[model samples]
Target chain A: MSLCEAEKTFILHGVEENFRIDGREREDYRPMEVEIGIISHAFGSARLRLANTDVLVAVKIEVDTPYPEKPSQGKLDFFVDCSANATPDFEGRGGEDLATGISNSLSDAYRSSKAFDLKKLCIMKGQKCWKLLVDILLLECGGNLYDAVSLAVKAALWNTRVPGVKSVGIDGKNVELNVSERLNDCVPLDVSGAPVMVTVCKIGEYCVVDPSAAEEKCSSAALVVAVSQGNITTVLQGSAGSLHPTTLMDSLGLGVEVANQLNIALMETLQSAPPHFDVGFLK
Target chain B: MSRKELLSKIGLRADGRRAQELRRIRCKLGVFTEPDGSAYIEQGLTKVLAAVYGPHQVRGGRSKAQYDAAIVNCQFSMAVFSTGERKRRPRGDRKSTEMSIHLKQALMATIKTELYPWSQIDVYVEVLHADGGVYAACVNASTLALIDAGIPLKEYVCACTASLANNDIPMVDISYQEEVLGGPTLTVAALPMSEKIVLMEMTQRFHLDHLPKVLKEALRGCKDIKVILDEAVRNHLVNVGSSSGWVKNK
Candidate 1:
């Protein structure tokens, strides 16, 4: 993704003019295409394509005993895999760093009880709990990976369905639970408070959301802010160059503002998603 | 693990296809703009995507470059949700590493590496779903991606899986259900025109007398795949040519 000096200058000047090379406003996000229930085997799945940054998320549920420290709460685990199809650099264990970084940020964003509630996943007090395993795979890297990954995770969690427990039997320290056989007996997860991350990249002096790969190369610093219902849940700074405190504050404000709007649009789109017609890479 | 018959009395497979019939194959080339070449393929329930990048200076270090032949590096990975049960890791696992090595071997036999000395070509395949014959699908998709990259090849390399049904009848293109039901699976990747086998692997065991028949069925399947891929290449060229107005000029 090397940009020549003149190309960098062109992008820097374009940002200073309040317009990006692709004619997008500084605060505007690229058109995003999202598909739900793409993975059949998983309890819930979603694929999000923000221009070329492609992400696929799947949520799998397993019942297990709750941790002694948190007997009333279930568990949430995030795993990220950066496929080599995105780039040769991600082959084998090469992408572990980036995958770990994204997964950790997601863990942090979902840590606050306001953003996600683990208690709802509990099946029984101190005995059985549903563990939600959210796995995200990156097929392509066009930049703004944090935002794309976060959105896909949220969508997947929203689509998740927890099987309903029909009965629980306790006999001699052995507890057995019967899950309902009916398909509609499953419970949909509560994702109203799921966080949505926005990447505010500072290109020259102007901060932009959803920076393209070319713009990302020109920028020296960026702020990733996760917002849940107009409240900031997590903030992480990725700085390739130093930034003033005032500039950081400005970027954070813009990130939260854009994230709130983005959240509304995402919910609307998910609500009005078209009926399934077997969509995937084939289409 | 059901005792249900794999092949019915009429000779139809579990999916209702004849023993000699391969599953439906649908493929598209140049699916992504970022990669030098990209392709997506669906063989029945198994779906795969392949991307090719290279014929340029080797990254990392120059010592890995070959003096007389180009380096072919391949990585094979599957999505965590691709299998019936979730996979803990996509790659770096023993199965994936073995698949990657086998993929590199099959592709190296077809690509013309002498023309681009001191360079490397990276072929990466990601499986979106796995219902069986995943390796074969990866090989096919990588060939299409290499073609889209305009890399020279001696001939197209295609792979197919075959197994013995009812302990006697040979079947082509074994699905996940068939593979699990029981029987030895013989996977062969070869150049159909030359009738040269680039790589071969057999799982489970059968009578020595039945080996030739199963191998022949697998090879025949590869040949059939080559025909389908050749047709796809021609159709792709026609579409690209027409869209570029090359055909109109003529």
Candidate 2:
């Protein structure tokens, strides 16, 4: 969706005036709606819609042997699928590049042990562990994909329930574990330290958070910052154009501030909603 | 071949539904604004989203455009986490490609392609959840999306799945449990208003003598589904009409 020179000038002027095309302040985000436990097949799932950009994340747990180097910690894998329903450009292998970018950034954001502790997934240390597969699906791409995907992923992990191990037996070279059969016998993952990403787009001289599709097209450089517990876990510079050092520092600060507020708001929403509330695309 | 019976002694299926009953179908049209038309549908636990983009000038290149009719392009995809087991890829797999071709065939049969010559219509469906009858759900959702796009159609295209139980009783709308129980499934997509079948597919082989009955049952299910969809369209029209104040005709 290319814009004419006149349209870009209009958006540039809007950002400079502290008003966006949607009449939002530079720091304001688009209205968001999030639903938890939307996918019944997964152990935990979430769907988040930020205006038109929609993201769905589901966490599936499986039993596997821990990695030899990281024997005491379980695994966390992220997969992203960009659907053609979002756009014809995402058909077949067209969206592979974008999917890989998003998944890789998510892995980097969660790589820090302070941001996300993997030890909780361990079932029997090196012998057995719970492997969590976090799959993200992009149903629509209005704009601000990084923010929406990160928020949805955090919610999904918070809802995930790792089954309790009833017993573990070792016999020479073989190790066996019995998972609790009762549905209630499970533990929810602690997500207080999970990072929330914020994309700060540099438009004209000002940095705007949560840019719409048109706004995104107008900006040439941006910073994607993932914040966890008031600290920055990951900072990815996405610059199509060179950024001044001062502007880059300014944007990073703005990203962290916005991400912290977003994390608090997300936790409040998750806490207020009942566990069995039925909500999805229908609502 | 001894296995658990699909239908219980009381004639209830595994999901506590009757033999001829369908799973609950709840659908909404115009779910997304970016697409020319979009729809979301839930058939029990199976959910699907469909979007239609065109009837506009051909994209990518001009060589693919046909002069006589609007080209129908279809893509079928499932979310990576859609199934009980995580799928490695969303689309471009063998099964997804086959479903895409079948979807194109079914949609082409109902759409009035001659109205938009030298143009293309892009229909994309994504399965959010896959319990059973994923193909049937995609077809139904795409039909609604096409309608929402205001495309000209001969009639609504509906699809349904039917299977034989006890080698005699034909069942309508098989679920995942039923599909896994080792029964032959007959899937049919048709223009129910005119009782014309556009596509028919089967998974397993059954006795040739029982083919007609199962086929008949599936067609009947399609017709029933069409009625439900028609009612939904009328209700949607009324809601839209009232919102736009179209009922002020004196």
Candidate 3:
């Protein structure tokens, strides 16, 4: 994944001409395969393979008291574990910092009401609510991790079916809730507004989406844009290097445009697809 | 006290398996393109992913590198959500550390270390789901990935788990249900072609007299798995050769 000056120039020239090494255009996304319910033990699970970047997302829901500030809203915790399987560099706790960073960003991006509505998860005010733990494991890192993770998480939530409550019984200090026997009576999560984060790296003169590991090395600064239903959720300026104000603004504009197009394509693919049985890793 | 008692009146063991049966094994190789070698294997409900990346130069301190042997580094981690209950951390636990060491031991035995003297071979195994026999699944998957990376090996390293159901009938491929039923579980990792057992582990006490039968059942299972894996490798090579226009007229 090392990118020298010569290699960077070759990529830049290819991007300028609207063609990539894999014969993809500037806006073209690599072929992706999404499968749900791979981890049978979890309530909801999905794995997405966007080229070489493989992301596995599993959602585990448990009943717990709601937050003091947001009494009616449920909890959504995100954890990104960069497994050593991804690379030798991520061995031990080496990847902890990056994993934490990705998890925190995901939490923030999905916190806003414009993105994901957390209120529906509340079962009974502050007493009883569902806590959805979205655990993301990074299996490989070819590049474009943000896109792959988001897609997998979204798909996992989509396939998640929450158990139905038939009745609630408050007996003394203990409260019991009844459920239906038919599993089909469960409710699925509404993910129409789930934000999809796209990492747009500013390499050399032009900005690019879905940068491979080599392109990422050459890039000075990057922008992470979270788009939900064509509306921008959050835009975070990243990268250790600096970016001019004008270039930053330009990057933001392109980010939103590309995010919108990405969403449309994503929705079209998810909606028209059949039930995916070939889970990730297994594929 | 007989086969009927071992299988019970329902004709099923503690985990509901026939005495001479194996757990369902679902596997895939080259699951990731970034890694030089990667594979995912699910034996029954236990799921493990093994990745291999090297034959390349050894990183870090040069003093550790041997002039005549390739260093094999292994790390084993299980997902927090993998078990029945949540785990505190993925690795660094006592069980994970032990598993990691055992993995290194198993892989090193098969990989031809002498071929790449000063180079380091890294094998990382992650357990996504834990039913039982985590080490065995990891070892098998790692073997597939190493072959996928085109690394030379003395023989295919296959692993399997066995447990004495009702103290006599040896059940091949133990599952979570069997493990929880308080039986004598034995796991073995071996080079099947060489008939050499590289690693052998057992949890709980077992009768010395019944050990031989259990070990024999496990080895049979390992040999069966090795055959399947060999066939898969051959099929994969054929597919790649035909697609790359290297299809030879047979």
Candidate 4:
């Protein structure tokens, strides 16, 4: 992703004009394509392609006893896998740092009870709980993984169809569950407040949104802000360089403003998604 | 795990496929914009994506360059959510290492290595979902990616799985259900036109008497898969060639 001097100048001038090299406005997000239920075997699955950045998210549920500290609530675990297909550098354990960072932020974003409720996932108090593992695999690294992964996570959650429970019978110490009748019934997960992360990269005294590979190279530092329903969930300042508190605040404000529009488009995109639409790499 | 339980009384497998039938295959090439060649394939529930880069000078070390052939480097990784339970890591695992080695061996046999002497070609494959036939899918995917990269090949390298079921019947392209139920799973990667087996891995044991039929079924499955892959390649080339204005000039 090396940038020549001329190419760097062109991008800098474009940023000064508030128009990115891709012709996107400061608050505009690249066109994103999303598909749900692409993976049949997984309980819930979605694939999101934002320009060239591609992400696939799957939700797998398992029954387990709740933690003693949180007996009544269920569990939400986020796992991110950066595959080598994205780049040759991520062949071995090289992508662990990026994966761990993304997963941890997702965990924190969903920790808020308003964003994702874990209580409804409990099958029984203290005894049985549905542990949902939201696994995200980064297939491509065109750019902006946080946004792509977050949007795909929200879509996968929406597409999730929790199995219907028929009835439960508890006898002396034995519990017999009868769940055969409501096989077709399903419950969609609540994801209205799902957070979407927007990254603001500081390049040459100016801040830009959705910086591509070349732009990222010139930028010495960046900040990632996760916004949920107009509120800032978390802010992650990244790069080998440092950011002052004032610059951090400025980036957070920009992330918030851009994320509001980003969230609206994401919600609309998911809502207006065409069912039976062919979703794959060709498009 | 009994011999009779390998297949049902109705002559159907655990996933209800006939002994000679193969799972459905769906694939798309050029899935990404950055890679020189990329493809995504689904054989039943097993989904794999492969990206090819090179025919250029080797990266990392030049000492590994071949004198009169291209150095083929391959990496095979499966997503943590690819299996029934989430995996702790994607690569460096025993199964993944074996898969990578098998992929490189099969691809090296098919690619025209002499044309790019002292250069390197990289084929990276990621398995998004693993139900069964992972090895076969990865081989097929890498073949398509190589084709997408415009790298010449001796022939289409195809792979398939075979299993012995119900003592007499042989199953082609065994699914996850059939794979775990019982019997032997024989995986073969072959250059379809040359009918040369590049790599063959067999798991479990079946009587020597059943070997012929099961091996034949697997070969038949490989040939079938070759047909599908060949058609895809032709269509893709046509689309790419025409869209590039070559036909207009002609």
DockQ of prediction 1 = 0.75
> Quality of candidate 3's docking, in CAPRI categories?
medium
lDDT by residue for model 3 (B61-161), tens = 89989999999999999888898786768898899999999999999999999999999999999999999888899999999999989899999999999
lDDT of 1 by residue, A1-20 (tens): 89999999999998999888
Pitting candidate 3 against candidate 4, the one with the higher DockQ is 3
Per-residue CA lDDT of candidate 2, range B1-250, in tens? Answer: 2357988778888888898899999888888878899989898888999999998899889999998999999999998888887788888899999999999999999999999999999999999899899999999999999999999999999999999998889999988888999899999999998899999999988899999999999999998888888887887788788898995542
Evaluate residue B132 in candidate 4 and report its C-alpha lDDT on the 0 to 100 scale: 86
Question: Poorest 10 consecutive residues of model 3 chain A by lDDT?
Answer: A274-283
Candidate 2 stretches greater than 4 Å from native: B1-3, B248-250
Best by DockQ: 2
Models sorted by DockQ, best on top: 2, 3, 1, 4
Mind giving the per-residue lDDT tens digits that candidate 3 earns over A1-283? 6667788888878878888767877767778877778788888888888877888888888888899989999889998899999989999999999898888878878988768888998887767788898899998888888878888888888878888778767787666767677878888989889988888887667788888877677777888988888777878776798888998888878888887887777777778877756555654
Model 3 steric clash pairs? none
In model 3, where do residues sit more than 4 Å from their true spots?
B1-6, B14-16, B247-250
Report the candidate with higher lDDT, 2 versus 3: 2
Query: lDDT by residue for model 2 over A18-130, one digit each (tens)?
Result: 98899999999999998888888899999899999998899998889999999999999999998888888898899999999999999999999999999988878789888
Q: Tens digits of per-residue lDDT for model 1 on B1-250?
A: 1366778888888888999999999988888878899999989999999999988889889999989999999989998889988787788889999999999999999999999999999999999889999999999999999999999999999999999988898999999988888878899999999999999999998899998998899999999999988888888888889988887543
Which scores greater on lDDT, model 1 or model 4? 1
DockQ of each: 0.75, 0.78, 0.77, 0.64
Mark the regions of model 1 whose C-alpha exceeds 4 Å error after superposition.
B1-4
Listed per model in order, the count of residue pairs whose N, CA or C atoms clash below 3 Å is 0, 0, 0, 0
